[model samples]
Target: MATLNLGILAHVDAGKTSLTERLLYAAGVIDELGSVDAGSTRTDTLELERRRGITIKSAVVSFPLRGTTVNLIDTPGHPDFIAEVERVLGVLDGAVLVISAVEGVQAQTRVLARTLHRLRIPTLIFVNKVDRAGARFHELLDEVGARVSPALVPMSRVDGLGTRDAAVTERVDLLRLADHDDAVLAALVEERTPPPVRAHDDVHPVFFGSAITGAGIDALIGGIVDLLPTGRAPGRGGTVFKVDRGPAGERIAYLRMFDGVLRVRDTVGEDRVTGIRVFTDGGTQPRAELTAGQIGTVRGLGHVRIGDTIGVRDAKAQQAQFAPPSLETAVLASRRAELHAALAELAEQDPLINLRQDDERREVYVSLYGEVQKEVIQATLAEQYGLDVSFRETTTLHIERPAGAGAAVEYNKVAPNPFLATVGLRVGPGDGVSFQLAVEPGSMPAAFFVAVEQTVRETLRQGLRGWPVPDCAVTMTHSGYSARQSHAHAVFDKSMSSTAGDFRNLTPLVLMAALRDAGTVVHEPIHAFTAEVPADTVPAVLPLLARLGAIPLATGAHGIDGEIPAAKVHELRRRLPGLTRGEGVLESVFDHYAPVRGKPPVRERTGPDPLDRKEYLLRVVNRRLTPSQSST
Candidate 1:
């Protein structure tokens, strides 16, 4: 049988998990639907997810829909967890964008749509919860068209049963957005377009109704089966997004196959394939072949990295550069001692974490997520690695920039020995925000050049004010090394020791925290949400939304039958339950990050402790060392 892999995405609490459950039930994969609130959802099996009632990780499940085996990946809605989404997106055939009918377009919805547009992935919009009160179908449809794309067209409409609390009684019609291709356009105008051509059009289609009522699920499922592309041919392939270690210590790499067929133990030239697994709404099952356009996990090849492509021998020829995990936070032990080795191991797993040492201060720095992820790291150490550890409060991840165009560093002599390697390197802003350090060798040995590069990378970790440096170009010229030095230990120590003085005068600036594209503010994550409440609570709820910077999109009697007012709020409101008179429920996901509004009240940091203070002074002194001008 052929396979199809797609993603289901939406804002948090937008019923994305709920809809996944309903889809599984509707397809007969599950005996009954599971509820997110009840913590019984099939995909949200993580302890953190079940406790919080939110998806923290992406999940892949397979089901038979319209004679096709569909692998659906459900992703987390929180912005903090977007890395999970980005990793999963690398391997999907297409996407199902779930937009809440009541809440409409939100900050997260906009961010995600822009990401989709950038990738040019084909999309289908599902406006869920149509049976709920105050569900604005046409107005929200217009919002989707205006904000996301001009191509979204409705596939089905809901007709009300009556003014009473009657359920959604009828589906008026199923429509498809007109195709963009000229051949189809000409055929449609001349009445020559085939029926199947009209049915499986490339235009974006929108389906509406409640996942609870099963009002329009059949048509929605039919459109997905009909429209989503299937890769039946061989030679198509994709890169692995995220890798997980199973209970038996096997590494399973989740893959999105774009253009080829993959089978268990199939060797594509040098690379070998072994353990292969496919997950379904039912459960995980072993598979022999995962052809093009399908998503699944491959195992046994422990050497594979997250972004590696599997198929042809020269896989890199067909692969695109993947942005490795950038967002990071440090997980530190309460005591300052175990910091070094702990960081080394962390770097092995996530090299992007950029773990480095502050020799002067006798401390270490590591990049990581928020407090919760930090806790996980500490726990992982104690539970898995048998190390007891406590953590400190999390801080913003910052990078360093050059104060000006470039700074020159010359390395000449070592501390105890007369050994010398003279060099000149100019450091400036490079292509991206990440700094570039180069060593143009004059007479340095190959091993010495390699050592210098590694040393420079470590020293570049934090600048004068202590922030990781960003994109800076480096040029190495006029350098000579001692033949007596056999390894990196000597060269690494000498290079870093010499560059200390120049780094001080060169002056480094801190690159402020910001999001890509949408200029960043020290924005905290907000959950765009909706709630159903008794009309009397409107007076109370209105004030709460305004206080939290949440904008209300729609509020009125939903067609779900009742006087209950369905209202939408844009930002987080933990106190919402108290304001509503036990009548309404909420749906929300992480919105975009925003600037920390207003003058952040200032606070002074207590100077480093005695040991840290002593270390800082040594760092200051080291910055003064300079090789004589005549050394070159």
Candidate 2:
């Protein structure tokens, strides 16, 4: 059977999960309908998700539609878990974007719609919650056209909406509407057969429905099967998008097979698939094989990580970059030694939860999107790992960039160098952090090239500002190794040795010297935000935003667009509700890094400063001096 990978995306509380449950019921995949409020939905199985009535992670479910298999991916609508949505977007053949009939187009709705459009994923819009009071189809449709895309054409019109028996009637020629490129229209005029809807087309077919009452669901499903295109055959390669643990504590890699078949025990790269499980109406069933255009879980892939491509050596799965975590908090635990171990497990699930250790402070820090995510982490630890933990006050995570350009060199064979390698490098500002090994033939053995390049890239992790450096370029202008020379071993002969370790050790010293000469500037992450408020409150909100260093973009009758420092978003979130009498809507997304205008707050250093030559060398090379001893 042909397969289709469809994603369900929406703004928070827009009935996205409800819509998924309805679709599953409509397809007869489930005997009874599950409600999001009751926490019985198939896609949302997490305890935290059930309790909170929100989807915290993307979940995949499959069911038969007509003669085709539809692999549905239900993505988290909450902005905090947007990373989950981003991971699934790379694998979708099409998407059903859910919008609330009552709420009209929301900030997140626009974000999702624009992203789907930009990615060129053919999308259908579902105006859900038609049963809710204040639901207006015409107004919502206009809002969608104005806020989302103008090319959105209505597939049907709802009569007696917000009632028990709302009826839908076909309003447009779907074949023509789906003919976004006018190919179908041309075919009709030329007396030739019109083609099926192209999945990459810009035109979006909008469907009106109430997911709760199951109104207008059949039409939506029919639209999907008839209008959406069946994807090409899967390739042998696929990307691991999620990692979980089975009942036996074995690793489970959730993958979207792009091409080729993956069989049980098939060795893809270095990892072997010990087992395969494909989703079915009756839960996952063990499968001997998985073909292309399928989403399934595989076991025994211990080293596989999110965004890793299976069956392809050294290939990286391309995914949309998520916004950097703007806030961080210290993890407070009584069992200090076990904290890192527990966090490592959490990091395996959500790589965005970057865990850092502060040896000097004897504390653990974690990156976060906001306070809600912090609470989730705290709860996750207590529930899953049985480790109770609290968090200190949150703080901003700052990054640095190069201010100029310079060069440095380290000759390992010389006295006091304490190694058998020679390295030289140059540093300058670039669009982002990057490394290149520019070497002349015979300058170094071919075997040493990879080691030298890897070492340089690793060393760039730390910069003079005590944060990961960004927007800088490093190139290895020179590299060498000591010739085999004999030295007295015991009382007569000498020995010679050359290893990659020497190059790795010397890398820090040379790179730091270059960074110091080049100088560095710190930049803080900023966010572009939009706020919808009462028309009368726009004036009041303007000055408040200005006080927070926000630059106004546009002032509409009931909304304002602006940019603000991400660090101050929490303050805005706390105050916006009361200012607009609970009717206001505020949305913020990471924009770009801007240079700190004045004195910047200091951040805790992660490692020894490379500029401190003697201390760094003693700490890294000698390994005898403790952190305190080396500093002293």
Candidate 3:
């Protein structure tokens, strides 16, 4: 049997989840359709998700459509959890982008559309909620062409739209199809059945329906069966896209098989698959093997990770880079021991949260997308870990860039350098964290040289000014090491020979000194925005934008385009509804960062304070050694 690995994506409240449930019912996978409002949806299994009435993580289910098995992945729509959607995109054979006819195209809808297009994943557009009052199919259709993609081809039309009796008909717009392709126009002119259009990521076929009433879903199903292409596998491996815990709390990895077969007891890398589960009839069933083009859960892969290639050493999995967390908060709890470990486990599931700790402040910090996610974290900690916590004021994460070029050196037995190693380093502005060596690789033991280079990169994580220093290059200008020598006892004493530890401790002092001379500038995250408001309220919104540190470069048709500090985006969104009487809308994507205008706030030191030589010496080396003590 063939397979269609499909992704259901939409903006929040756009009814993608409803569509997933509707698909299952249509396929006879469930007895009756589940309601999103009642918190009884089949795809949404989490208690938190059921209470919130939203998808917090992506869920996978399968149902047979015609002769093909459609593995549907229902993903979160809220931008707060967009990271979930992002992980599912690259592994999908196709996608269904859901939009409500009443709401038309939204910011997140546009984002998902563009990402799908960029990844070249064939897609179909579903304009849902036609029964809802104020639903405008024609207007929304036009809006989709203007904002989302012009390659959209309407495959069906609605009758009695915006009413309970609304129905979908088998309809195709020949004129629009002709405009998209020359052969279609020629075929129409010749008075013949036009060439069939194949599904392509560049050309989307639109279907109008209401997932709630199941109106027009049959026509949409036809599109899924006919228009979308079934992918073929090349090798015997796959990429792990999503992960969930089994009933026994063991790892269940969702693998998208691009080719070949994976059977129970088969080993992927170092770990063996002890069990296999395949989705069927709306739930999972034990399967001995998973074939190509299927999404299956493999158990007992003790060391599986998202994006890891299984069975093949070189299986290609496209990595989609989504927006990094822009906000962070200090999490404080009475049970400090449990708090850190729980947060660390959560970080394992979503590494973009960038969890870190501050020993000085005795606080744990987690990166966030917005307040809703923070609330989710707080509730999860209380409910799952039984730990109550509070958060400090939310702040924007910043980065530090090298301001100039500088160099520093620490010689063996040099005063203030207690280690028996000589290391010299140079720092300069560059793209990404990079390291180069001017000294020969054979100048010292490979381990000692490696320790110096590794330490240099790690120390840069907390730069001289506290913010992480990315997009910089460092070079080992000089390197020397003491050979292992027999002292009084003829034993391998670290003091007699330079060790990797010596290089590790000494590199930070040298790197920080070089970074100090090089200088650094804090750069704030900026978001480029396109906003629309009521024409009458444009005057009121312009000054408000300025007040929030926005630079509106262009204004036309009551719309503005420019950049705003990411720190102010949340505030702008809050006031937009009231200022525009709920008619305001904005779309913001991460743009180039800019230097802050004023003094930047410093983060509490989580690592060694290399600026304070005495404190640094005590922390790194455990004690300050005098020149006499260092003498051979």
Candidate 4:
């Protein structure tokens, strides 16, 4: 049987876990169905997830359906947990996007669909909760088309409306026919046609069912077997999307194989892989050989990191198909009265998460998505890492311009050993946003130049105001250092920090926070939602949108005009209590960091340093001065 590695994803509380429960039960993996509200869902096993009744961490489960082994990666629905979604997309060959029937397509649904589309993962849509009250089948299908995909395949149609006793009809062939283009459309003009395989359909397969009442599950299961993609082996190699703490704190990486077969104890070169773990709805089992195009976990690969590819001995010889994004921002420890050692260790575990300290700002920043992510990092530091950590709001790294032809700063200006070097430096914008730095040729030893390069990176650990130094280039044209006095460590400090400071001073515009700017406007996350409440509730909800700072784009014309509302996170959290009121679930993603219009409000700053600057100055001067020079 073909192993189909598919992800079960949706907006939070869109019944993804519940559907998984039902799918598992139907496949006899579970004796009974687990509930999400009650927190018995298999995928939502984490303590934080269980307490909140959401999927914070991605869970892996597999089951058999019609001779196909369907491996499902259940991911978190809340926007805060989007990293889980982004990481999972790396491994998934395809995805089953669940759109709540009662709520139709929501803001998060649209965001996730866009991401899936970008990842080029073939998708299958599931319109769930058809048995719920206020369910509008046709209207919901229309919303799917408008919001998610125009080529959505609607396989099963509901017999009745809302909770008026709905039954699923086997309309797979009709939906598949609708997926074809005009040329294919003309072929369908004939009386009867041989039903094309699900893969041949130009559109994604869309199935309808109520996960709660188990309505239409069997047919949906059958469709999954028929429509889902199939593959025999892994690709050339595989990419590691996420690393999870397994039983006993063992690091188990959930990976997707792209092109090569992975066996037990196989090494990604010299890195030894001890074993492979396979998870299913029946719980996790062991596997020996996972070929290309498969998803499995490798055990005891200590050297493996996220985005690492493991395959044949000469796998690197094979052209790499997957290209992971490079590290954008670097975050480090905050400089306060005290430092936390645990925080440093946390940063060490995730090399993608780098850290550097800035003596000038006396702060450490850990690069992240945004301010909200900063808050999450703080929480993680406190709760998981057992440390009291705080963060300054994130700022992007910016580059510095050179004084003239080139610029270079030397370390060892004082006591430790007086090593001095001055090399001209110039900074200019390159092809992209990152600035390029160039150094003068043969100005310093190959060893010394490498030290300079390392320093620049460290200096970027904390830029002028403690933010990362953005992309920029630096060139050292002419530099000289004391042959006897300059050490590798000292040069590293001076070069990096000085270059960082120079860049900061030369450039007037520091790296600004990446606000969601589009055209002449900045856009914040606006939840494009469709809520199917009673007609009486529509008027009540419309006013609530204004209170939430959301603009109602349009309301559905069918039964209860469901409006696609766009609202901010803070406003939505506050207004959703009264808006949802046991009526619907809301799904939204980080739309764009819209701009704050007008003069742009200035931030309030705290004045007066409590700590003596003299103390810091003394440390700097004392470190720089030599004992013999002090006497002189």
Least accurate 10 contiguous residues by lDDT in model 1: 509-518
What is the C-alpha lDDT profile of model 1 across 151-187, one tens digit per residue?
Answer: 5556776676211232443242223234434554565
- TM-score, per-candidate, Cα-based: 0.66, 0.90, 0.90, 0.69
Top-down lDDT ranking: 3, 2, 1, 4
Off by over 4 Å in 3: 177-195, 232-236, 260-263, 266-270, 311-318, 403-416, 420-457, 473-480, 486-490, 528-532, 553-562, 582-592, 611-613, 625-632
TM-score of candidate 2 against the unseen true structure:
0.90
Listed per candidate, the RMSD to the true structure in angstroms reads 8.6, 3.8, 3.4, 8.2
**Residue-wise lDDT of candidate 3 within 171-234, one digit each (tens)?**
8886766777888889999999987876687788999999999998998999898898877324
Rank ordering of all candidates by TM-score, starting from the highest = 2, 3, 4, 1
lDDT of all predictions = 0.57, 0.79, 0.84, 0.56
lDDT, model 3 = 0.84
Q: Write the per-residue lDDT of candidate 2 for residues 361-434, one digit (tens) a residue.
A: 88988888777788888888888778899889998888878889989876755655665778788999996667
Clash pairs (backbone) in predicted model 3:
432-471
